[model samples]
Target: MTSTATHLTLNRTGDKQPISGFGLWKVPKESAADTVVNVLKAGYRLLDNAADYGNEKEVGDGIVRAIKEGVVKREEIFVTSKLWNTNHAKEHVRPAFERTLKDLQCDYLDLYLIHFPISLKYVDPAVRYPPEWYYDGKGPNCTLENITIRETWEAMEELVDSGLVKNIGISNFNAALIQDLLKYARIKPAVLQIEHHPYLVQQDLIDYVQKNDIAVTGYSSFGAQSYIELGVDHAIKCPPLVQHDVITAISKKHNVTPAQVLLRWATQRNIAVIPKSNNPERLASNRDVFSFNLSADEIKSISALENGHRFNDPGFFFDIPIYA
Candidate 1:
């Protein structure tokens, strides 16, 4: 078997693999045809889009074009999509993934995720609460009465059996929720995608995932640099990774850019990373990770930058009782 996954490694999720290339959530939704093609040409074998990104069609087009030009084989690409917040109902899970596949024009997903552990009412693409926020207690939106996290987990497990998704994972889930899921989950979550960076290293959570033998994936590894346009101005300015004395010295020492150091920091720690870059040149730089290795002490210096802040906090959606 060629191993349908693009990233060349596996974790204990029974059958899960990581994809490197690019994560395309924050890119301008109406990116030009040439822009996407350029990204693929730059060597990003993964395209991370979601039903919520509202740009799966564009991503799919890029993939088709890249294949047409012989940039890479369809199997050589690792395509991942996520079920939106509104479609967390057990019955709605597969249907939602189907829509994503339809838009992305793919036969099956390398990996599919529940998007978040919290569920809410099924909101459509054209809605005010675009992110799928809702207050109903008994619906997908309300974590109170309608659909519970465990219910959503069971549905995700069903997807794997159906073959719509190669593997399943969770995003934005905390340690407590992850621990609780282990008690009832028929299939353990293969990956826990969380926001990580020098500013928010999340040591305890990473340790727990490793102990459970789950492959961990890091998102937003550059902290708020990517979020500046998404209303994270604070993350945009505070404690810039480029300004870090250690990062600067290392960049000069290795004659590499600071962003490369940032990405390598996570990979060196044995965690998966999905950094997004729409710029063709930057995309190439991002995937240039395997070219250089970071030293042990330098990795520690960068890893020590955790200040206990979380970027993609979902407190407005699901309220875990542990906070009490």
Candidate 2:
């Protein structure tokens, strides 16, 4: 079931990234391997993963099985992973990447990203891997490291120099930080991944990065779906994108699911999307977004749903308010 999905050409390496990919954010380690295999069989070539996901090992197992069974070749898949916030210091960057590469069982990553701009104190992998938010893995207290982005980015460039990562980019970065990064970045960022749904359009940031030739990848395309499972108040209180009147109307008009309409709303505008689902039917529908086109008025109607709402703010769960 190979897909004729659209591709976005990256900057330095000219690598073509799939416009629609599978995100492995909250996937449990127990089911990660099976899920990865299924998605690959369903025609997902781009796998968006991270050390923070705590399921890379299982995800890698799936990839290995998929390749061994001839579901898809390694080169046919564009594997992407991220550097966790705890591994932002210069000395920790390569070692952290090495661990991820080992876990994924890959020689090199198609795209590697600094998961977030916020730097946290390093937690040894032996102490606790994928150290999320809290320094000790148990607390209301979170510590910040003094490491600058420039230092971490320099180390990222070294990964490129070593030919381990084909392209390096940032996630959850704003325009100002991007401007600063460009001033000193020897290897320009090839992509920018952000929480972009109709509720959080972020059109200005998208326009700015796209103008610079940095492709954009949108995660959480369904808005409140992922966060509602985590008991987030903002997400719980917000309207479900799949059920929203506008989305439903558009979906009916296009004869597609609301999920497909939401994804198409982004991909139609040239922004990439990483949407995950365990249901086999939904998986195929999600990747089939490029088949239809939304009218100019429908796109505007979807964008009109923006209310500056953001569901993935670290501030909501931790002391660090990166968005604030």
Best by TM-score: 2
Output the lDDT of residue 27, model 1: 67
Find the 10 residues in a row with the least total lDDT in model 1: 1-10
Candidate 1 ranges with C-alpha deviation above 4 Å: 1-8, 11-19, 32-35, 125-131, 134-145, 316-324
Q: State each model's CA lDDT, in order.
A: 0.72, 0.92
TM-score per prediction, in order, is: 0.87, 0.97
**Over the stretch 26-124, how does candidate 1's per-residue lDDT look in tens digits?**
666577345567776777666677777767777777777878998878777777788887788787777788878887788888878778765665755
RMSD in Å for all candidates: 4.5, 2.5
Clashes by residue pair, model 1: 119-140, 120-140, 120-141, 121-140, 121-141, 137-145, 138-146
lDDT comparing candidate 1 with the true structure: 0.72
Q: Tell me the lDDT of model 2 at 314.
A: 80
As a TM-score, model 2 comes out at 0.97
Most accurate candidate by lDDT: 2
